[model samples]
Target: MTTQTPPVLALDVGGTKLAAGILTADDMLQQRAEVPTLAQEGSAEAILGRLIGLARDVIAAAPERPRAVGVASAGQIDPRQGDVVFATDNLPGWTGLALGRRLAEALDLPVFVENDVNAFALAEAQLGAGRGYHHQVLLAVGTGVGGGIVVDGKLYSGSMGRGGEIGHVCIVPGGRPCTCGQIGCLESYAGMRVMLPASGYPSLRALADDYLAGKSIPAVDEAAHWLGHGLAQAAHVLGPEVLLVGGSIGLLGERFLADVRLSYAVAAIKSYRNIPIVPTQLGADSGLLGAGVYARQRSGD
Candidate 1:
């Protein structure tokens, strides 16, 4: 008989896509799958049904049935209570959802729910860019500029999972509209959805190529300016030893980090400029991997 625990099922839900995988006790991803979120789909229940079905398919792909499940969702999730307090239009009708209990009942196994960005931070802190650092901060600039904070090598979600929401920080102060119904948030200024088009670039890769070739794109530079300011502000409060940038627009935080550093030097206090900002090692799969590890740990397995 094998003493090793059965693999855990990990699900990562984002505005653009949904991904699922089976993670072994050793942190190996055994089976994985993906699908478009198509958030236009009328209701949260309807979308969740699709994800549940997709999760089932991936779970079966593995040799053994997973004993637990962990979900990383893009919203204001209360991990301690296993519910969603609020969500942006990114995931319509996601507010006040009892995702943890619902999934536990449906899957017949223990379930853990986490904010997607927090999950990313946890994964990076353990296995990626933030490794070897006592404190780390992760800024995921995908559809929006989501952030996660790790303090003293541990995930830091404030009392109600509201600790590391760096995306909503008001950098522009009425400059751009945010999905959170706020004006001039970091998301408004740096989110790829708004920043990419504003800069006249079709994609982050295109922007990266142009910037790497020593060309100046208004949109990219503008984003860096805001991001640097945001980072500087975060540095004062969080005091992390290392900072990581990730998500689709990151492109290894290549040209972006350089520009950010330039701005950060001007905005942050003299001493705070010493913080090292780097690219995330786990680009797209941080949430998936983190969900698995988090579930296993929280479940006491």
Candidate 2:
């Protein structure tokens, strides 16, 4: 008789979307489902219930029901305790939610939780852009800006679990206020939510299309400047072998990459100009795949 690897169920909670899937031990995701997260319309309990409902839907859709669950959430997470230690207003009522305990109890399965960006970096270290490099950085520019670092093959969560949070790095002094209670953060300038509106465009898709068509997009250029400056700072400090950009905004296609690289070339120190700044190979599935990786690793404990 042959024993097969069990499947892991993964969930990702964002301000705008909730996604779930069953991941095989081999890192393939199946039976994926996604839905909008209407944070303002519900209490913490109601939102949690909705998340669980989505999980159940994916579970039912999966070919093999999974017994272990992993969650990657957008907020400050206490991975050791499997709790959401704190969440800013970006995710209403997500703070202090004991996600691991709550889900473990509700579904009668082993659960693990991680900061979403950290999870993304973990997956990158395992099989994505950071595959061979021991020092890597991941920057995600989207609805919210997020970042993660891999040092010596491990996720670097500094004190307060905010290590490698490049989004909050102040790029402009006395600049716009950041959600993290700071001013002039990289996110303030480079985040899609901010850049899109500042672009005066209907949407990022439109802005990206125009940019790809070789049209002059002043707002996009400005945002690229901010992004490059931030990456320059990270390169100066971390000396990462590669800097990978991901998330909705980062994947705006090759033009975005080229623009950021051009800016980075000028802003970065001459010695560091050779570093490759590329888009994440894992794309949208990184968080889900990473969640599954964490779930399988922790379930046996």
List TM-scores for all candidates, in order: 0.89, 0.88
* Poorest 10 consecutive residues by lDDT, candidate 1: 247-256
Per-residue alpha-carbon lDDT of model 1 for 130-244, expressed as tens digits?
Answer: 8889898888887788889988766789988988889998887658778878898988888888887787877778877877788878888888888889888899898889878
| Displacement of the residue 31 alpha carbon in candidate 2, Å | 2.5
Error of 1 at 272 (Å): 2.4
RMSD of 1: 2.5
Put down candidate 2 lDDT per residue, 96-162, tens digits, no spaces. 8888899988888888898999999888877788888889888988866889988887778887576
Judge candidate 2 at residue 223 and give its lDDT.
82
Clashing pairs in 2: none
Clashing pairs in 1: 199-219
